[model samples]
Target: MRILTIIAATLGLWIAATGVSHAEATYAPQKVVYHINGTGGENGAGYKPALNNISNHISAVGADNLDLRVVMHGDGLGLLQAAIDDQQLQGIIAGLKNDGVQFLVCKNTLTGRNIDPETDLFDVWPEDIVPSGVAELGKLQAEGFAYIKP
Candidate 1:
């Protein structure tokens, strides 16, 4: 009877130790997608806030630990326009991209707005443009990406 009790106690301790080790070693990575579609004028008031929000997000999450993507459609394409050309915005976008944040433009909006992506966007690629902005957001959310509209 004493030997059985000792064996049971040893098994309980091993189980408890394994559980603690697993808890310490396991962590879920965060995945986020930000949506921006507001148009900004020459004064740039509308656009500045969105840029700031993106910067804040990157700061909040250690960039290396996050999977981030930004989807732009409608007037939001203006955020990526070549005409705005603010040095701060450029720096932020470049830095974010370096941190693995993808900036995607909506092809439909570009066509409706009559803006040429090749000329209007600073560094957007054809593959980066989605067929529909809102739909893409929905899809990304379903795929386990937390969505933020800013």
Candidate 2:
């Protein structure tokens, strides 16, 4: 029993020292798109939870091992609008973006809603605007990205 305990401790230390752990085995590389079509609630509560979920996802999968996208359209555009004023949301978004998560906005929604991406949205670039949210979602799915609506 004593020898077995010592061997176990040494093996564990060796694994840690070598940076070889179960995390790699536990999480496979993933391509995922999160669909957001509605604002969750008032006071940014609607999208805050969704953002939290996205953060938790990056934490679990490890940013380097994940290819993640957030596609927003319709009422979902409310998220960016809220972020424009909410510093907390902006921080969260910046962190997610730093983690390589892409936030894609729908152009159709912007046009129909008469939202000028330059002023109405938060940190949205021309490159971030998609022709259509739903269509982009379909394209992503067809490209082997797992679709998640939350």
Candidate 3:
């Protein structure tokens, strides 16, 4: 029927117009938490990829629009270890922090590994260290922070 055809056409046009309007609008604030549990060593195999993922994440959601946090636990503490002597990594981590990306280390991991946070982790404060990394992540998720494992 002509009426049915006209109705479909009108609906389609309305949807198209609404889509265009939405495309022109800015996005709301996005929050994300990245969990790192893998250890990447001198070969820079796994760690490099995790770093790239973090970089891509920041790029995807304009850094300014994101409340990004990297939760390091288990073997992932190697990232902090890798940065210990590397000034370049320390600088990059500091820059990321300055841009609002937080780096959280697990206190349990430190105690289990017999590692001292004061010397091993650069720029990490006592308050930033959580009692349980995974539990903290779950808490963050409950608080509406998106979860990511990279």
Candidate 4:
């Protein structure tokens, strides 16, 4: 029993010294894409929870080990629009961006909706625009990014 206790303590020490939480070590690096096609109704209600899930996912998997992207098209563009006026949402987005999350906007949505990417959306760049959101989703999936719609 004493020998077992000592071995357990030594294992714990090694884990602590490695600077990796058990959860982080347990999860392999992941390529994930989140789909956003709706505005989640007024005030971007569903957006916050979805963003929160991404935050939680980063926490669990460790940002360095994750390739995460958010593809927003259709009414989903409202996420950026809503963020334009909502500070909390903006902060969440900025935090996610700082953690290396890529936000992809759809050009088709922009042209169809008559929304100006530079002037209307929040913190979106030219490189961030994809020709079609759905196509991007498919491409990402083909590239082995797991699909998630939340």
Candidate 5:
């Protein structure tokens, strides 16, 4: 647990150092979409390390240079609810949002689960809801965004 925290902190530091860095963004155009459909009662903790990987990515490349998206569907809907269940995760999602990380949720998931997008989902906008998460992934991939499961 301690090691994971340390690593997460390090990743956050790296992300902070970049600060929407344009140089890194212009140097290498990295467009990645993180696909998450966690099983086993999915939530933010299910892939907290994955968040670190994204931050590390920005650190390695640059936020301005990277077109990063975290598309969550199926059980992954738990990510938006994670902070609601565990208050500790409150700012985690907010931080990613601040760094311009696009958090997309499936409309199907929302409808199937009967979750109200505006109220149930934390800080989710209408634009963030996609018709189908899987289809969105395909569209994004076709657009040249690298798909990352982790």
Candidate 6:
């Protein structure tokens, strides 16, 4: 009976090991787009929480295996406002960018607000400015990128 118990335990261990290995073998890269249209004072503050989720995702899948982009338009353009108003907020954005996060601003919002994307936005370049935020979201999804709002 003791020998039989030992065999059963060995088999259980083998099964558990294989199950873990199978799960790890299924790892796949992820592409995600985060949509933010809330103003900085309230809605913009939500970026921190969204960023936390992104960090957790990268932790689970590894940074090199993750493609993440943030689209900011409408009142959401206020996200950059905190960074503009405070140097600390600017550092926060810089840190995230270092982690391969992409921040895309909307040209339509900039034009409507008479804000210059090149000069007014921090670390924002011409390429970072999409023609329209909503349209960009659609394009990203069509390109096989999953969408999230925070």
Alpha-carbon error at 110 in model 1, in Å? 1.3
Instruction: Report the C-alpha lDDT of model 2 over 32-117, residue by residue, as the tens digit.
Output: 99999996578567898889999998888888888999999999999999888889999999999999999999999999999999
The candidate, 4 or 6, that scores higher on lDDT is 4
Candidate 2, residue 142: how far the Cα is off, in Å? 0.5
Sorted by TM-score (best first), the order is 4, 2, 5, 3, 6, 1
lDDT (C-alpha, whole model) for all candidates? 0.77, 0.91, 0.80, 0.94, 0.81, 0.79
- TM-scores for every predicted model: 0.74, 0.88, 0.76, 0.92, 0.77, 0.76
lDDT of 4 by residue, 33-133 (tens): 99999866788777999999999999999998899999999999999999888899999999999999999999999999999988898999999999999
TM-score of 3: 0.76
For residues 1-150, could you state the per-residue lDDT of candidate 3 as single tens digits?
999999988877886887633222345678889999887868335676777787776666667778999999998888878887877777767777877888899989999999888887677788889998999899999999999886
lDDT of 3 at 57: 66
Residues 1-150 of candidate 6 have per-residue lDDT tens digits of 999999988877886887643223345778999998975565346667766776776667666677889999997777786567667667777877887989999989999998876566677877888999999999999999999986
Give stretches of model 6 more than 4 Å off: 1-26, 42-44
Q: Over 4 Å off in model 1, which ranges?
A: 1-28, 82-84
Write the number of the candidate with greater TM-score, choosing between 1 and 3.
3
The most accurate candidate by lDDT is 4
- Candidate 6 accuracy as TM-score: 0.76
What does candidate 1's lDDT look like per residue over 17-81, in tens digits?
87633222333467889888876777445777776787776666556567888998987787778
Q: What lDDT is obtained when candidate 2 is compared to the true structure?
A: 0.91
Clashes of 4: 0
Candidate of highest TM-score: 4
Better of 1 and 2 by TM-score: 2
**Which is better, 2 or 3, measured by lDDT?**
2
